[model samples]
Target: MITAEKIFKSFGTCTVLNGINLAIGAGSTIGLAGPSGSGKSTLLRCIQGLESPDSGRISREGYPGFMFQDFQLFPHMTVWDNILYAPRVRKLFPRAYLEAKADRLLRHLAIGQCKDRYPTNLSGGQKQRVALARTLILGPDILLCDEPTSGLDVAATGDVVALLKSIQNEETTIVVASHNLDFLVQISNRIILLKNGSIGADIVPQELEDPIVHLRGLCD
Candidate 1:
């Protein structure tokens, strides 16, 4: 489980997160949605300790893994190398186990054919899958994604949604931050809307007649 209380953060003069409070249960998939500058990324960063809040407290029960917005795969390494590098450096698992896990993840993500290719040669969606495989290889209890579907076509976006759903397990928590409401609605069980550094609405998608319309405030 993860909980935040009265969280506040700023960058010099511009305040980002303002007195935010929320709780996330284990195995829940949460989507943080808002317009640009709405604090979605900041909140994810804070949760993962990439940025510290000036006030309030956040408690996380397990290890958190972050996937950056840019899909930061190493340009110098092949896909296989990129996915295995972190665990190898940390010595978290034996070489054979890591290799096996990487192979399985690549196959599961439908990128097995690209394992020998470099990031420069792969498409945006392929890079995203590689980054995901790298993060999943570490077996984190909590996974955070930032603008996961930013640069993909409709088919690729669908692939991402399906891949994410396939990886969902009772022990792994997933949090995705994106401006795309439709994408979030498809993948997240709960959607939290942000506006002007504060939560505008916290919704259970299944409870609403139409989550996207409600999230957009189209109905009275």
Candidate 2:
């Protein structure tokens, strides 16, 4: 559903993505893993149009939604407001539809009771689910997640994993950029290792041992 060709991006003198090329098929879950400053986040931003490439091209089909590494929910807004904000602003759907979708997402994500709470009142896991509900409420065709399990504990991470897998289907493409290799392996059909602004390795996660070792080595 997304194709990036020889994508090159830089910030002043520092290059973040160099000669990046990849094609993500529809309904696939692709994981991007690497150490700090490896361009994982930068690549996701370019795909989401949050950043423009200095050169090369990125083409994508359908609507794209981004979930930031840090949950960027408005602190003043309750979960209900935060989840419905984007569709409400875009008026992409009827008010009744938006509200119904928001309600369903909150329930599906197991955060129904938290709808009345503010971000400040949420725990890390609750906040993550709320953020996910907000993103999923829009029914994005392609979901770009940055560190979906960043601050969650093991149990919470497991919950996030299950949730992601449950949402996978025949139309949505999921791309996750994270430092958590084990987590990625669990959810990603394909894992890509990024190093120094380039794709270091890309492999299927079937034989998890070797891929995990290789990915960890690159990060180290």
Candidate 3:
């Protein structure tokens, strides 16, 4: 499980997260929905330890893997190399073991054919898959994604959503921050609405008849 207690963050004089508290259960798929600059990305970064909160405590059982909004792939490396980078850097496993894991992940994501290609050559969805594969190679207990489908078309968004859903089992927790309300409603079991750096509502998507309308009410 992951818990955040009275979390607060700021950049210079601008406050981002303000007295935020949350408890994310294991194996749950949570969607963080809010307008731009509502601290969605900041919260995810804090949870992943990429950014530190100015105050409050965040506790979790294990480390999380973060998938960036821009699909932060190494432009100079091939897909295979990009997937192997973290494991090789940390020396988590032998080269052969990491290679085998990468091969499996690439195949599972249906991007095995693009292993030798660089990020520049792949489509938006393919790039996202590669990024996801890279994160998955580390076997994180939690996955934090920032705008996983920000620029994709409907088909591509569906593909990414499907991929995410496939990996959400009994052991991994997934938290996604996205502007795609429909996508979130489709994939996430719980939805957290944020406003002005605080949680406005915490609801189960299945309980809301019109999620978009409910979300609009909260934001407005």
Model 3 C-alpha RMSD to native: 1.9
Expressed as tens digits, the lDDT of each residue in 38-77 for candidate 2 is 8988999999999999999999999999998788999999
Alpha-carbon shift of residue 44 in model 2 (angstroms)? 0.5
What TM-score, computed on C-alpha atoms, does each candidate reach?
Answer: 0.93, 0.92, 0.91
Error of 3 at 104 (Å): 4.4
lDDT of each: 0.89, 0.89, 0.89
Q: Give per-candidate clash totals.
A: 0, 0, 0
Model 3 CA deviation exceeding 4 Å by range = 93-101, 107-110
Return the TM-score for candidate 2, rounded to 2 decimals: 0.92
Candidate 3 residue-wise lDDT, 127-192, digit = tens: 988888899889888999898887778876777777788889888999999998999998898999
lDDT of 2: 0.89
Report the lDDT of model 2 for residue 15.
85
Per-residue alpha-carbon lDDT of model 1 for 1-220, expressed as tens digits? Answer: 8899999999999989999999999999999998888899899999999999999999998989999888888899999999999999999998888899898888777889999999999998889878888888998899999988887778777877887898788878899998788899999989998888888999999898889988887212
Deviation in angstroms for 85 in model 1? 0.5
Model 1 weakest 10-residue run by lDDT: 211-220
Cα lDDT over the full model 1? 0.89
Which stretches in model 1 have alpha-carbon errors above 4 Å?
A: 218-220
